[model samples]
Target chain A: MAPKYKLTYFPIMGLAEPIRFILSYGKIEFEDNRFESDKWPSIKESMPFGQVPVLEIDGKKICQTIAICRYLAKQVGLAGDNDWENLQIDMAADTVTDIRTKIVSPNYETDEEKKQKKKAEVINETLPFLLPRLDNLVKQNGGYLANGKLSWADLYFVALIDLLKFMIGFDITKDYSNLSALKNKVLEIPAIKEWVAKRPKTER
Target chain B: MAPKYKLTYFPIMGLAEPIRFILSYGKIEFEDNRFESDKWPSIKESMPFGQVPVLEIDGKKICQTIAICRYLAKQVGLAGDNDWENLQIDMAADTVTDIRTKIVSPNYETDEEKKQKKKAEVINETLPFLLPRLDNLVKQNGGYLANGKLSWADLYFVALIDLLKFMIGFDITKDYSNLSALKNKVLEIPAIKEWVAKRPKTER
Candidate 1:
């Protein structure tokens, strides 16, 4: 019997999109249970770690976005062929995570002026220093984020680019041809395309 | 032939300690290359992603402290028994990472007043909220961080607790009895004790 999967998160493409992409890629059926933002505060105390993007597999609640994605990656055979290769894939995913954290830190700033300043720094300094390196990595790896073949990291990067652009209000990949190509590659996947076409539209 | 291992980081034991602990727990020999902070600028450009705690496995350099630790965990048989178990371990480790990031962010603040305020928030707000939950997890797992056994998450937690204390200038585990017991359980490992006995002493 197929194990039932359900993901709980806000109705936005933030952290949960990568897990959603992985499930869509594998054609696995899952409950993408997205709640409204106002409902989060009431439900927050009951979450396993007081965070969203929790994946319930066979009724076992799993916390952490990357952990959920990694599990799904393993299930769908999108993980590395060997332990070492898996490490490389993880490294790529983590690099993207580093970028995401830098971009989102400003979003959470309580002070509006400070938030704008931090956002500027992230766009001007952090993005320039990091995105080129990531582009080179994808280029060197022959279009994939880790190895020559597709992995969950590729899905993670493409999914995150949408959020990144939305947060920064700019085209983050305009100059990076490889990343753009990689984004297109991920978007072209039939399952991913289907998910994108049908997934709920949100402001973020 | 066993793969050659080399860890590059500042003389301080921060992120690299967890990787060292995993290697030590497995009785694997590695070169602990600690460099002075003054020498970082010259070497910074050469590092992958311009960060320390880079693990060089057989001359190949891997970036990101968590990625390096995860790789070493697999090498030392400290990883989970299966995909689901691995996800649990990863979730535990990632939770620790989240706490660590919150505590360390203030360390880089340029303003003294802001830094102190942030530090206070980390101690008064963050620790109070996160530590008890972590301690409960340890208690529920029968003294281990995950899987009711000594996974890399256990080692990672114990190793990082020292750095956490140094950065915050207080014993973080004082109020959390189960976490303290978990630390003792990790510290009592024969190989881990051996590593601690001969390891370099540094002020974080």
Candidate 2:
């Protein structure tokens, strides 16, 4: 029997979108459960680790967004065929995550001036330092993030790029031709395209 | 022929110790290359992502400390037996990483006052809220991190707790009995015992 899958997350494309994209790409059926911010406090205690992007498989709950994405990616055959390849994909995914953290860190700052300063640092210093490396990697790896083929890292990056742009008020791939091309390639996947078109719009 | 393993990191166990522990646990021979801080700038360019805790297998380099640890754990027979089990372990490892991040973030603050404030919050509110949940997990999982037996998450948490205590100035496991027990169990492993007794000490 097919396993029953249900995902609970806030109604945002922040962390859960990659899991949603992977499941959709695999044509797997899952409950796309999204809750509002106001409803979260009451429901938070029921979540594992009091966090969302909790995936329920066969009625057992698993927390951690990346872990869930990795699991679903493996189940859907999007993971690497071997441990070495998985490591490469994991490295790429972590690189994308590192960039995301840099952009998102200042958003938590209560001081408006400091937040603006950090945002400038992210835009001017960090992005220039980080994105080119990623762009070069994609170019060298034949347009995929790792192992010269499509993997969950590709999906994860594209989904997060949308949020990054929304958060930082800039198109992240404007200067990186390779990342732009990679994002287009991922979005061209029929299932991904369908999901992107139909999924709820998020502000970041 | 056995694949050659080489780990490169700073002379600190902040993030790389779990990889070292896994390699030791597996009895795998690898080059344990540690460098002083002053030498990093000159050597940073050659690294995959300009980060430490890189594992060079054969000749190829893999970056991201957690990714390296995950790969080494698998090689050492410490990973989960199957995909779902791997997911469970990954979730636990990520949870530990989250807690570590909450503690480490303040250590980088340039403003001394803010750093102390953040550290206070981490100890007063965060630890109290987080550690009990982890304590219950350890208890519920039959004294190990995941799947009721030793896994990478157990090693990861145990290795990080030392750094956590050194950073926050508290033995985190003091109130969490199961966590303290888990630490004892991990430390009792003969290979880990050998590694920890001789590993270089760092001030968090």
TM-score of each candidate?
0.97, 0.97
RMSD for each model, in Å, please? 1.4, 1.3
**Runs with alpha carbons beyond 4 Å of true place in candidate 2:** none
Q: lDDT scores for all predictions?
A: 0.88, 0.89
Total clashes, candidate 2?
A: 0
Taking the tens digit of each residue's C-alpha lDDT, what string does model 1 give over B69-186? Answer: 8888888899999987898899999999988888888876656887898889988887887888888888888888888998999899889988988888877788889998988888
Instruction: Write model 2 residue lDDT over A103-129, tens digit each, in one string.
Output: 998886767888899899999988888
Q: Give the docking tier of candidate 2.
A: high
Whole-structure CA lDDT of model 2: 0.89
lDDT score for residue A108 of model 2: 69
Q: Score candidate 1 by lDDT.
A: 0.88
Give a tens-digit lDDT track for model 1, residues A22-127.
9999999999998988999777777777788888889988889998889899989899999888999999999999988888888766568878988899988889
Where is model 1 more than 4 Å wrong at Cα? Answer: none
What DockQ does each listed candidate score?
A: 0.81, 0.82
